[model samples]
Target: MRDRIEKRMAEIAVIGLGYIGLPTAIMFANAGFNVTGYEIRKDVVERINSGKAHIVEPDIDDLLRKVIESGKLRATSNPADIREKDVYIICVQTPLREDRTPNLTYLESAVETVAKAMKPGALIVIESTIPPLTTVRMAEFIEELTGLKPGRDFYMVHAPERVMPGRIFRELVYNSRILGGITPESAEIAERLYRSFVKGQVFRTKSTVSEVVKLMENTFRDVNIALANEFAYLAHQYGINVFEAIELANSHPRVKIHVPGIGVGGHCLPKDPHLLVWPARDDFGLIRLAREINDGMPLLAKDLLFEALRTINLPPEKAVVAVLGLAYKGDSDDTRNSPASAFVEAIVDDVAEVRTYDPFVEGTHGSLEEALRGADAVVIATDHTVFRSLDWETLGKLMRNRVLIDGRHVVEMPPEGFVFKGVGRGEY
Candidate 1:
């Protein structure tokens, strides 16, 4: 069945070639599908046409280059080329608004574009994460625009892209896939499209269930981190070691707690929580207390930093604060909704002369030594690997003071004068 479907879907049109889209396009092309990567950005379209990728994803550059060379992949700002493809995958952005509401503008626009050009019996897959109702509504819109009932004339499915930004290439083909279609036929077609390349299991369900599953996956991580962050705060107050506590707790068969940190950040984690909260209050007549708890974390980290400075008899505004790591996570340069960025920006705005160092971000500071120079205090907000490898003796010498706030519990200290603080590690 899968092989027969693969023979049917010879061409795939991937819309909105951002981080997820480009990589998906390349993966499909490498799997021998004729892949057309569509983007409205002229520069991006031209870059891919010239066998280059604008977005930074692992192995995508080489794969795109190869597939393009093999006449299996192409890119364009135009949709006429896109209309000819049998499979359409939407991978646009679904961000939160300034008011913290789920913003679906990019997604709606993608749907409008795809609806206008898609042919009969074509399979449409939405890989962008969205609120549960989004896929069903998009399917309705496609029916409305294409003048064809979803199950009969065309098929649509939601296979929310589960690929992490840094690990996109491997996860695209290796991680498990979910298929939620407007109809069972749509789901079956979507499953075949995925099975052509995906070695991972493709579970089948309805569109709304798949939508919530994607959001739930990210929200679960956010909620876990929130617990970790709260414990980190409590540990700071009690002078306990959180890393030790977490390690001890993990000894239990089912007590798998997350590591404490300054705050939770990243495009998905920060945004998905809000999506659930807004629809709960507005659409579903429910309150979002847990969401608020997680959302309050960045502020809590900031307030803790001020209290830490006070303990050392330093005014936060007067202290030269150094921030270690600006990316949301270690070993990657993506800063979209980075928790560290939020924390540092708050510190910069509220009360501090903040300097930041990230090995991934070149030219921000020539070296970690340069970023931490003359600091009255160092706030290890992001757990980049280089921060862990820092020579503590050299750090002590370079700093104007010795108060080290290990927001991520990544620092090792000297016994004499250094004080370290991490969530739940209430001892340092």
Candidate 2:
């Protein structure tokens, strides 16, 4: 198996070709592997096969086009297209339920599909972030379905992907990977396969430890961000800019502070902390409280908007709000578990009208000027690079009222003649 992987002779099947899966398939294909991408979404499959990507990410279009045109990669919705592959990499999402429980249905379904289609000696890899012990449980489930004993007749490994959305392709090549195998041989084979394209460091360990490490990485950030958000709340009370305070505190060299924002967003930070504590027998109060603090940040942004509205003597029902960006992060269109969506949902019923404009996201206003044309207030959600250099003084002429709310701290200075309120900017 190692020799086949090193020579790029192993046929690879990547299941769930969404954000992670498609890029992964492209990387392997670009690395000289014959890769077939299996996605349940027919539209995504058609798009990929046509050398286009469904999601927006840097360098995805050109790289996907390169692999697709080279005939090294193809995407299919049909299960038969992926049958009896030497390698199966599952990159499905393991989201959280409404009550903050880990939802493993997608992971289980992908594993079941791989079990039904895999050969005896095939190597199976799961790149999804999941609860601890899930890979072990999944190996047993596959054994029950396929009657093939794990580590003997087959090999299984939990290889979690650790890349951000905007820099996915670059990070895929540079980010260090952790391969947690159910057995020692499983980790070794998966490491060799990834080393075909990965230039970063690779480490092997037990499946459960890797799972805990992935979750802990996100949980640590979530907790630190929650601390920063708490400082923002304190800044509101003290009337001092938390950003400046954080900057001054960091001068001490031991006081590194995470930037406080409207909310934590994207797929990982909000959900992984919940998944980390979901299966534990003991209560994890700090982890759960961090999630709660981060989740409530949107409401804090809403409060700032309302305070600005009150200062302008505009009623909430009569105000027209324009939300600048909808995606979870800057320069990417992936909105899974986005705090911008949460903020919009929180104020949708109260506001008279809400206009959204994101350059990368569809189903919003055609242009930023169109969204702000008669709107009373403009709220900057995602801090896209374009927002940093916006000519706010010129654009303010299009508004009914020049009320600016900076949720993501895009505006460093308050433009003249506008009522500006920003998260962590204590002067309201």
Indicate which candidate wins on lDDT.
2
lDDT score at residue 55, model 1, on the 0-100 scale:
65
Candidate 2 structure quality by residue, lDDT tens digits, 148-233: 99999999999999998888899999999999999999999999999998999999999999999999999999999999999999
- Candidate 2: residue 25 lDDT (0-100): 97
Model 2 residue runs over 4 Å out of place are: none
Model 1, C-alpha of 396: deviation from truth (Å): 3.1
- What would the TM-scores of all predictions be? 0.92, 0.98
Which window of ten consecutive residues has the lowest lDDT sum in model 1?
A: 281-290
Q: Model 1, range 297-324, lDDT digits (tens) per residue?
A: 6676677677778888988878887778
Q: How large is the C-alpha RMSD of every model relative to the true structure?
A: 2.5, 1.0
Residue pairs that clash (backbone atoms under 3 angstroms), model 2: none
